[model samples]
Target: MPISSKIARQMEEASWIRKMFEEGVRLAGQVGAGNIHDFTLGNPDLEPPPEFVESLRDLVVRPRAGMHRYMPNAGYPEVREAVARWVREESGVEVGGKHVILAVGAGGGLNVVLKALLDPGDEVVVFAPYFPEYAFYIDNHGGVLRVVETDGQFRIDFDRLEAAIGPRTKAVFVNSPNNPTGVVYDAAVLARLGGLLRDRSRKLGRAIYLVSDDPYKKILFDGTQYSHVFRHYESSIAVYSHSKDLGLAGERIGHVAVHPAANSAEALVAGMTFAIRVLGFVNAPGLMQLAIRDVLRACIDPSVYQRRRDVLHGALTELGFECVKPRGAFYLFPRSLEPDDRKFAKVCLGKNILIVPGVGFGRSGHFRISLTSSDRAIEASLPAWREVARAYATV
Candidate 1:
C-alpha cells in the first residue's frame, strides 16, 4: 500500500540539515575525516554531566521493583513532584505534580500537546525561522500552521503576530534560545505576546494557548535571562527536555508542564494524558524518570558552551559575515553572503564545509552553524570559512 498523501507530502520535503549531513559524510569519506568541517546538526559532542551517568548507574543497580515498569500515564508522581519543585523554585510559580506530564522528550511532549488541543482546521501560530518539525507536528494533528515572519533579527514582531491570531487559532509555538537563530526572546517581548493573546482570547471569547518549546531554556550565555512563559501567560504549556541542558539528548527524557493557572487546566490535563496514550508513548521511560528525580538539579556547564559560542561567533564575524549574536543556545545564524542560501551552502560544501541552509528553517538568505562540535573542529573550520568569505567578497 502507498503511504498516505499527508505523510507523502512530508517525506517529499526533505530536511536540509539532514541532507547536508549526508553530503558531509560522503565528502568526509572522499576527502578523509581530518579535512572536512561539518556543522550540519546540533548533536552535541560534549558528554553529559558526571552526575547524570552516576544517577543512571545507581538506578540500574537499585532493587526498586518498578524500575522498568510503566507508571501512571502522567508519569511517576515522585518524578513529577521533583520537577514541579524545581519549576517552582526557578519560575516562582506554585506548581504541583498534577501539573506535570512526563513525555519521551520535548518532541514527544509537543506531539502530545498538539494531539490534545488541535481540532481539524484549527490554526497554530508559529514564528518563522522556527524548527521545521513544528509544521509537521501541527499537520499531524490536523491543524493548520500559520507562520508569522519576524524582523531581520528574528526577534518578535508584535504587530505581525497580533494580526495572525484569529478565532480559529488554537495555539502558538514559542521557542526560546531558539533553534537556527539562537536569539532569546526578551521578557518584555514575552509580556507583550501574553497581552496580545489575552486580548485576542477576549475578543474571540475563547482561550488561545501558548506552547513553549523550551529544550534550550537552561543553555544561556553572557548572563542572559530566559523567561518562564507561564509566568507571563496564564494559558501557557511548557514542553521541555533534558537533552540540551543535561547533555542527555539520547536519553529521550522530558516533561510537559501545563500551567496550573490555565483556564480549563483540569480538562487540559485529562486531554494530555489521553493524548500520551494515543501517541503510543504510554509513559516516558520509567528508569530515566526515576534517574532525573535524583539529579533534578544537575546540568551541563554553561561555560563550556559559552566558550564555544564565543569562538564560533568571533570566527564568523572576523570573516565579515553578518550574524545576530546568539545570547543563548549553541548556534549561529549567519546571513548568507548571497541571495541563494542553497547555492551559498553548495559553495561551502565545495570547500569541504557543511552548514545547513536557513531555508529549511522557513527563512532564506541565511544559514545555521551548530557550535556543539569539538573545539578542534571549530578551530579547523576557520580556514574554510575564510576561503568562503573571500569568495563572497570577490563576487
Candidate 2:
C-alpha cells in the first residue's frame, strides 16, 4: 500500500542529524567506534544527577497503589502542583496546578500548545536557523510556519519579524540557548520582543501567544545569564524538558506552563489538557513525572560540556575555522570551509568525522558540531579536522 503523501513529504525533510548519526554508526562498524568521531546529535554524555537516580529509587521501592496506572489527561494533581510551585518560585508568575500541563517531552509540549492555539491556516512565526522540528510540529496542527531571518549574530532581527506579523499570525516561537547556534538571547531583547508582541496584539485585536521552547534553560557557561519568559511576556507558554539538564532524553518528561497573567489562561490550559489527550499522549509517563517532580532543581553540572566547548572551539579556530563562541547548549555553528555546507560535511565524513550540515537548520554556508561527546573523542578528531581545513584552503 502507498503511504500518505504527508508522511512521505515529512520523511523527505527528516533530520540530517539522524541521517549523519546513522552514517556514523555504519562507519563505526568499519572503523571502530573510537576511530569515528561522531558529533551529530546532542545526546549528553554525562549521567543524570544523584538526586534524579535517588528519586527514581525512592519512587520504585515505595510503589503506591496505581503508581503505574493512567493519570488525568493533564497529569497528576500533585505533580502539577509541584511544577506550579517551581514555576512560581523561578518565574514569579504566581501560577497554580490549573496552569501546568505535563507533556511527553519539550517537543510534545510544543505540539500540545500548537494544537490548542492554532486554527487552520493560522501562521506561527519562527526565527531562522531554528530547530527544524518546529516546521513539522506547526504543520501537524494545520498551522503555517513563517520563517524570519535573524541578525549576523543570530539575534532576532526585529525589522523582519515585525513586518512578518499579520492578521493570520497566531503565535511566535523562540528557543533560547538556541539549537545549532547556541546563542542565548539577551534579557533586553526578550523584553523588546514581548513589547512588540503586545503592540501587535492590540493592533490586531487579538492575543498572540509567545511560545518559548526552553529545554536548555540551565545549560549555561561562564556566568551567562538566563531568565524565564513568564517574567517578560504576559501571553506566553513555556515548554520545558529534563532531556538536556537532567540527561533524561529517553524518559520523555516535560511540561507546558501557561503564564498565569495571560489574557485567557484558563481556556488555554483547558485546551492544552484536551490537546495532550487527543494527540495520543493521554498523559506524560506516570513514573517519570513522579520522579522529576521532586528533582525539579536538580541538574548535571555543566562544566563538562563547557570544557569540551572550549577545547573544540580553541582547536578549530587555531586551524582557521570561523565560529561563534557558544554561550549555552552543547553545539557549535561554524562556517563551513567552503560555501556548500553539504559538500563540506561529506568531505569531513570521508575522514571518519560526522557533523550535520547547516542547511538542515535552515542555513547554508555553515555546519553544526554537537560537543556532547567525550573529550577523548574530540581530541582524537582534531587531526582529521585539521586535514580537512588544510585541503579546503589549498583548493
Candidate 1 ranges with C-alpha deviation above 4 Å: none
Tens digits of per-residue lDDT for model 2, 1-395: 39999988788788466678788889989998878888887887789999999999998898889888887999999999999999999888789998998999998999999999999999999998999999999999999999999877898999999999999999999999999898998789899999999999999998999999989889999899988889889999999999999999999999999998897999999999999999999999999999998998899898888999999999899888889899999899999999999999989999888999999888898999999888888898889988888888841
**Local distance difference test, candidate 2:** 0.91
lDDT of each: 0.88, 0.91
**Candidate 1 at residue 138, lDDT?**
91
In the range 201-222, model 1's lDDT, one tens digit per residue, is: 8988989999999898888888
Poorly placed runs, candidate 2 (over 4 Å): 15-18
